[model samples]
Target: MTEKEKMLAGLPYQAWDDELVILRENAKLLCHQFNHLAPNETAKRHTILSNLLNIKGQFHIEANFFCDYGENIYVGDNFYSNHNLVILDVCQVSFGNNVMLGPNVMIATASHPLDPVARRATEFGKPISIGNDVWIGGNVSVLAGVSIGDNSVIGAGSVVTKDITGNGVYAGNPCKFIKSI
Candidate 1:
């Protein structure tokens, strides 16, 4: 399989492969263009995002947004993200409808091997799935392979390292359930 195929399949792959590098470069260029546009240039921004991401419906993301591979990021309807959002979507990063992300939220699907020798030679990633109507507060970091269920609220400054069931408020590092909502 190709490096991109291996990456998408959650298998170890060389991240420095030529095809992967070109894809990342293209994404970065598009992100740069999107981020540098005038605040009032809504139409232009929309056009750029449409070309970059797999947005299912209406969505709005503030400036300073960055991603590893735009094609690997899929956002559902009514998605909104505040400024400085970074998504390292080496694998699929899927967001359900009506998902809102506060400022400085980083969702990473990329990971390195634990073994030092293998880590330097290859990288791996797992997909992240966020259910519908989820609200992630500011400065939250959702790690690789996490699935957050629908109607969940993640409090500010949390680091989520595990799957979160729906209809609850979760907070703190290694985010724990606070109370059912």
Candidate 2:
């Protein structure tokens, strides 16, 4: 299988593969243009995002949004992201309806192997799924292979390392369960 196929399958892949490098460069260029678009060019922004990602319904992402492999990211209806949103979508990153993300929210699917030798050779990724009606606050770093269930809220500055089930507020570095709504 090709390196991109391995990446899509959530397996270890050579990050420096020529095709993947070209894809990343293309995404970066598109993101750069989207980020630099005039504030009045709302329709163009929407068009760019629609072309860049697998999206549905009405959505808005503020300036300075960045992603790797825009094709691997999908956002559902009524999605909104604040400024400085960065998604490292080495694997699929899917978001359900009505998801909102605050500024500087980093959603990453890429990770390195624990073995030093392997880490330098190949990189792996896991999918991240965010269910409906989830609100993620600012400066939240979501690691690979995490699923945030429906009606969940992640507090600002939280580092999410594990799966978060629905109907609760999660906070802190390790992301603990707070009150349930």
Candidate 3:
């Protein structure tokens, strides 16, 4: 059987790396489109905010929200979410002050398996947190086990998979701290 099939069968597996890579690629594609899509507004803000989902703070959407299960998400003051924002929030996703999310940005708190025999279908999640004054560029994906520090700037098309402590600029897959901001 294929590795994906084995994982989906719900067998025991250690699945942090393999799932993370696939998830990053998928999320990157989604965010890429989200960043470029135009907002559907007639008179006022035609933002996408689902009632069946949970959202905090005075929501200001300069775009659309394709959120999946919005129960575990929170936004802080002066928050600005640009077009094509998708959040797969299975666990807590907290964003701090003056957080600016560019187009097609996604914050996902989900995971799967690594072992080919145990990677097909199993799923899990971790928490994500963005500190104050964080500016995330368009097409950025913040993965499950990530916590960005205050005053950090995530460049466009970057994928963050680990905790960022110092304030700085980060970009690329498996986002690395580029420079102090």
**Leading candidate by TM-score:** 1
Each candidate's TM vs. the true structure? 0.99, 0.98, 0.69
lDDT of 3 by residue, 8-113 (tens): 3433333444654565455444444443455554223322342323445565665456654444567777788887788876567888878899999988876666
Q: After superposition, how far is residue 106 of candidate 1 from its true place, in Å?
A: 0.5
lDDT of each candidate versus the true structure: 0.97, 0.96, 0.69
Model 2's TM-score against the true structure: 0.98
Model 1 CA deviation exceeding 4 Å by range: none
Per-residue lDDT of candidate 2, residues 115-177 (tens digit) = 999998999999999999999999999999999999999999999999999899999999989
What does candidate 1's lDDT look like per residue over 3-32, in tens digits? Answer: 999999999999999999999999999999
Whole-model alpha-carbon lDDT for candidate 2: 0.96
Model 2 CA deviation exceeding 4 Å by range: none
By lDDT, rank the candidates, best first.
Answer: 1, 2, 3
- Preferred candidate (TM-score higher): 1 or 3: 1
Alpha-carbon shift of residue 20 in model 1 (angstroms): 0.3
* Cα misplacement distance, residue 176 of candidate 2 (Å): 0.9
The best candidate in terms of lDDT = 1
Worst 10 residues of 3 by lDDT: 42-51
